[model samples]
Target: MEIKFNDVNYKTKLTDINITLNNSKINGVYNYNSFLKVLLNPKLIEKGNITIDGKVYNKYDPKVIAVIDKDMPFYTSKVIDEILFYSKIRGYKNNNIKEDINNLLEKFNLDSNILKRIGHSLSETEKYYIKLIANLIYKPKIIIFKDIMSGMDYKNKKIIKKLMEELKEQGVLIILTSSNSNILYELTDEVVIFNKGKVLINGSTNDIYSNIEILLNNNIDVPYFSLLTYKANNEKGAHLFYRKDVRDVIKDVYKSVS
Candidate 1:
């Protein structure tokens, strides 16, 4: 999605702006207090008027919460509060929002009992809540994860890789961006190199690795087995790219020696 601003004016206390999403006008009004509130505390509430298929929405409607998945409960609660505060203005009526809340909590294996006691770190719980909401709402076509495996140990990383492959098979666009080129070489079909915000190279993992200088410059280390092959190939005056090529070279060397 592309965003553009038009006829924008900013003052110390007042700002008028227009925001376009996917080449359509999504926000046109300016409220300094609301803008400041959002800027100061982004997680306090969900901002911006959302329009799906050209229909403008109040953004606190159940359908809106359903679509956004109430991922940030605090923000959702704020939205609920705002709705209640302006209930007379919007002609809103109270309903059983608890059912929806319960359904959301159930996805994360959370219950009201646990929520009340809440000895766990708020950040961790927030992450779980966000993930649950994201999964519940807007099953996105493309999901990009960057360096998620970096801090994880082997066992946890393996689980993540397996989950990624499963998501890939389910037709989700899974893009894993990592500095660990060896891991990417083992797991991904393609590799893309970025330098100073520009795409330096993009090709099959094997193809990109053929240029060792580019990989080294980008801090992408070659795999250990590949290093072995490099040494063997240098002794025989041969250059090979993929592991299969290296195996064939080794087999040829064995045949000649035997």
Candidate 2:
């Protein structure tokens, strides 16, 4: 899923330019279906093309859909049912899909029995839906996760993070772009800064965080924890990354106070 851009130039007037994406990960919860549609039909990539597994996906091809539920009015049961039906017919295992749907239904306190009547059982049907989605993801060397954590609570965000880690471990080239730098840093190993139709920097998350001046110049805000460490370093103090590191530092500070 390596992307190599050669002699690539974009127009200033165009806000969205279609570029070839090699193993690019898209992030967003609502954009799941849209992404899937793009994967299945390459023509949909007119805004941006993706080269996956040696196949060139241009605009108009269906993309991969990473389903994310945000308890929105638009995310109606009917819509979920429809997506499940289509996915099932297309030989997609319905396990994960069904589980996610049921989880959403339970959260909303909706009528779970009604869904069962429509071939969505808590037992077999749920597993089927998950299997269907899993089938869709079979041998996926490149994955695009669109706005995966939008509107997700902390608990749900943790779940998504675990899933992301699993995907990364599976050797899937994951590209996730999000407005939430905290979540992005937590989830992705690499970061690509984009502003006003330009790539400001591409590097590891830690490297990007270390370069606060570059981030500020590009209009990208540093994550809060990174800012905290940066301020401490300015005061000739120790710096750290993970929460545990911060916690350990706090413990040392408490010991000094005592």
Provide C-alpha RMSD values for all models, in order. Answer: 12.2, 7.2
Global Cα lDDT for candidate 1 = 0.44
Candidate 1 residue 4 C-alpha distance from true site, Å: 18
lDDT of 2 by residue, 61-143 (tens): 22343332222122223434554654544465635666766665554335665453433343332433333333233334555
The numbered model that scores best in lDDT is 2
Give TM-scores for every candidate, taking all chains together and pairing residue i with residue i. 0.44, 0.59
Candidate 2: minimum summed lDDT over ten consecutive residues — where? 67-76
User: Which residue ranges in model 1 land beyond 4 Å of their true spot?
Assistant: 1-137, 210-213, 217-220, 235-241, 244-258
User: 30-84, model 1: which lDDT tens digit per residue?
Assistant: 1123332322233333323333235543233332222112233432233223223
